[model samples]
Every structure is written in C-alpha cells, then in structure tokens.
Target: CLTASSNTDGATVVVEPCTTNNAAQTWVQNGQTLLVFGNKCLDVTNGVTNTNGVKMQIWTCTPGQGDAAQHWSITSTKTIQWAGQTECLDLSGGRLTSGNQIQVWLCENGNANQVWNLV
Candidate 1:
C-alpha cells in the first residue's frame, strides 16, 4: 500500500505491507486534491514538470487549484497519473516488494507495478 512513512514534511512515500490501522497511509481527498497533511501536500515535487523517474514527495501545499504535479487522475483501468503529465506513478524497477519506492514514469500498457488499487 502507499504509505506516508512519516508525519514530517518532505517525507518519502513508499509501498509498505498493508495493515489494518494504517493512519499514516490514510488520506483525505476531494477530486484530484489529496491531503497528505494540512498545509504540506503531495506532489511530483509540487511544481517540477514532467520527467521520468521523478520521486513523488510531500511539499508545502500549492496555493491554488490542482496542477499537473498536484492533481492525480485514475483511468478506468486504474492507471494513476499525475495531471497533464504522460507519466504515471510507478514502482521503481517495477518492483512489487515491500519498501519499494514509487516514481513517475511513462505509462506502460499493462504493467502490474503501475496498476494500483486504492482500497
């Protein structure tokens, strides 16, 4: 599961083995807006543009509505992508093991590592 790893700002998000009480992994959202924290937010570095292998991180929240890095879109097939970017959230090295880091990469048609189930 996607987890916050910590409550601090600029924390690394990683795939951890799922648990029943995953408060650190829980998120409140409205549309594409994902609130990882109150003022700090999730981004592909908050404003950094489209680039492969960019590590997703928590940054001080952007002040306006969603942008490419700040907003996420999940296609019908469950492909989660950064808004306006060709890249989708990817498991580094396409690894599925615990503690694997997540990044943004060009969406592959049927990558098991790129397919995410939010529940």
Candidate 2:
C-alpha cells in the first residue's frame, strides 16, 4: 500500500501490505499519473534518481509539467514506466528488505525487481 501520512505534499510514498479502505492508500489514475491522498501525484524526489534507495513520494501535480519524473505509465506485462524516461520502479537489492525504499532504475527485461502485479 502507498500513502501520504498528512495527505499533503512531500509525504513519502509508503509501501506496506494493502489494507481495506485506507484513505491514505487510495490512488486515482488519470491517464498515466497516479494521484494519491488528494492533490499530490506520486512522484520522485527532485524529479531525478541520482542513485538507489530514493523512495517514492507524492507532490502537487503540475497541469502541464511535462516532466518525466512526475508522470508514469504501465505495461500490460506489469511494468510501471517512469514517464518518458527509461527508468522504472524497482525493489531495492532485487529483494525485499525491512525499510526498503522503492526506487527508479534502468529497466532490466524480465527482472523480478521491476515487475508488479494487481491484487
């Protein structure tokens, strides 16, 4: 599950086991973007990924930002695209670790770390 604890900007995109009817976990998809906790769209900090461990977060959506970091797209194969960039959401260390932060990295075909599935 993802969340914005304060339902506001700069809130970390939390990763947890999905629960029922949690307002913070709610997400609405508009085209390729995922809006969460109201006005903030799920985004990457600083609009770039300098390295690994940069966890996902939410920010106010720009009507025409045209920024890749703020946009997203998903493939039928279950890969989430990081806007127009070649990076993708990945599991840290290619495995689950306590306190792991979801990050954006170059997509590796068939890597389990970059795959996601709908519940």
Candidate 3:
C-alpha cells in the first residue's frame, strides 16, 4: 500500500500492508498523479534535480500545472515513472518490509525494485 504518514501536505509516502478501512492507505489516481488525504498528490522530492534516491512524499495537488515532479504513470512494464524523467519509483535498498519508503532512481530493465502492480 502507498501510505501517507499523515493527512497533510509534505507527508512521507511509505509502503505498508494494505488494511481494511485505513484512510492513509487509500490513494486516488487523478489523471497522472496519485492523491491521498483528498488533496495531496504524490510528489518526488526536489524533483527538478532528478537525482537518484530522492524520497517520495505527498504535497498539495497541482493539477494541470505541468509540475513534472507530481506527474506519474504506470508503464506497460509495470514500473511507475515520472513525466519526462528517466527515474522510476524504487524500493529503497530493495527491501520488501513494511514501512519502507519509496524513492526515485534511474529506471533499469528487469529491476524488481521499480516494478509495481495495481491491486
């Protein structure tokens, strides 16, 4: 589950086991961005840098603002990539444990850390 640390802007986005009736785990895909807490969009921290290992977070939704950092799409290969960027959402250190924060790193073919499946 992609969870927000809190129902507020600038909340850390982490992976947690999907649970019933958990609002934090509920995400809504609005266009190319994922939204949590109703108005926060999943964003890449300092996304303009496009640096490897930058953590993901929830920020105020900037719909139709052409903010590449907030634009995301799941590719045919099951990897989530940001608009016009080569980086994809990655599992930090490739760990599968809960509470693992997601990051953005260079997209690599066959990299399990970058793969995601919509449930």
Ranking by lDDT: 3, 1, 2
lDDT of 3 by residue, 19-98 (tens): 88788887777888887777888899877555899999888988574377899888999999987889998999988788
Give the number of the best model, judged by TM-score.
3
**In model 1, which regions exceed 4 Å deviation?**
37-40, 64-67
* Residue-level lDDT tens digits of model 1 in 1-119: 88776777678778888788777677666577666656545678545665788887766556785555678888877888777778887889977688777788888889887898877
In angstroms, how far off is 52's CA in candidate 3? 0.7
Sort the candidates on TM-score, descending order: 3, 1, 2
What 10-residue stretch in candidate 1 is worst by lDDT?
37-46
- What would the per-residue lDDT of candidate 2 be over residues 12-107, giving only the tens digit for each residue? 764566679877778877777877765678788888655555677778887865356678888877887787777887776765544456778787
Q: Rate the local accuracy (lDDT) of all candidates.
A: 0.74, 0.72, 0.84
TM-score for all models, in order of appearance:
0.84, 0.80, 0.90
